[model samples]
Target: MPRPPASHMPIADALRARIKASEWQVGDKLPSRAHLAAEYDVNPMTIQRAVERLIIEGLLEGRAGSGTYVRTPRERLRMVRSRHRERRGGSPFRADMAEQGRRGTWESHSQARVPAPDGIAVRLGIAPGDPTVRTDYEFLADGMPVQLSTSWEPMAITDGTPIVLPEMGPLAGMGVVERMRSIGVVIDTAVEVPRPGRATQEEANLLGISVGDLLTHIERTYYDTDGRSVETADITVPDVRWEIAYEIGIEQPEQD
Candidate 1:
């Protein structure tokens, strides 16, 4: 008989076990990165990465000036997706904007330009300095600025489209998918990436929050029929009120 393979686990798992065993408790500062590095016999970067994984898993929280602390045990957060496909249809930005409009809130388009940023350029498969339409909007929900989005499009394709207009009014009634279809483009796929970061001064001012507050940075890329990039957008959502859901497949072994 072959021997079983050793299990490879993340460092966060070890730290979590310590927390659960009461070696560390809520409000207790975790060991410094250097100290943890020595204890684990690993490099500082490895320790840092482990800490980051814990932060994302909500097993720990970081204070700007103080230190990292063990998070209190709380109810496990389970995100449920809508059962009906229709209810799940539409771009997230469009859905949020529509809800805001229904609540008597509105968004103001603050910036629209043609110069592409490095990140957007790479996603759109264009030169860093290539022409691209950039549109920034401040979304108000319940009469309060709650979210901000900056969307980009390849100018060669969208510059002549009516959707490039400064006002987001026309795009309001129709979602991005519908708008793209009207222009002979079909968005067949989308990819979303989420990262954690502190809100910038401008973002804080618009969202009425203090700078350095935790925020979710979301980037979405849409691909057209020919697998060509159609649009790319970056959105910032404050951590306190935003949530996302995804449908993932889980494979189970057959019963003996």
Candidate 2:
């Protein structure tokens, strides 16, 4: 049986479908809520709510005293990281650094307890208020800030190690992985999360870009063999200088 539309189909769905159909192109102003209400025979408030939702989703933008207009799609920035199993084999960051002959100095390190952010807490499987060790670094490539990373480790595991020492040197070459191994925490998997957002003031200064420029933020979490979370890190990179590549495969269907 064909099911009917739900009792309350969100008005945004209709607007989104029309936009996708090219009824409205980028920079095109959408009709006012009153006009849409008259056309759809729905309440003006419903149309307003729908338009608000579209704005929040980046599909539309509202101009004060003007009207809501479609937003143009921005260029996407790419980032590269090793896959889960590949990380276990070798560190991609180390390989890239060696290939480019890049050198960096240890920026800073401190052992202070900080509450985990909502996203970090969820990824680490810890309570939001749980304490964690935070390490901040600014990596330079050819004397320019190319990578900014902040790493967090749960106090329970890292308190006994020199994980927060400033003189630890480049993690890729410094046998930090070996240290973790000595501690009996074998990393089995690493997961990377990519997020698109505007660069912060500090990031803008470091990357030599105007504040609010688009950037690709990445957060990586490493898991130990016992299924426990070992480390979580956040990295930010300028959108222009890097590209992410992926490989995909397609399986053929059975003979018809």
Which lDDT tens digits does candidate 1 get at residues 1-256? 5333222246678987888899987889999988987787776777777777677556788899988998764332222222222233554444544543534244655344578888789999888888876767776655766677787878777676787653554664354566677679888777778888887888888886656667878897888889998889887877645555666547799999
Q: Quick one: best lDDT, which candidate? A: 1
Backbone clashes in candidate 1 total 0
Score candidate 2 by TM-score against the native: 0.57
Give each model a TM-score: 0.58, 0.57
Q: List candidate 2 stretches off by more than 4 Å.
A: 1-79, 83-94, 104-106, 162-176, 246-256
lDDT of 2 by residue, 147-256 (tens): 78888777777665654442353343342355466567787677777888777888888876546556778888888888888778888876655665543336689997
Error of 2 at 101 (Å): 3.7
Worst 10 residues of 2 by lDDT: 166-175
Native-structure RMSD, model 1: 10.3
Error of 1 at 145 (Å): 2.2
Each model's lDDT = 0.69, 0.68
| Candidate 1 segments exceeding 4 Å error | 1-105, 110-113, 166-173, 248-256
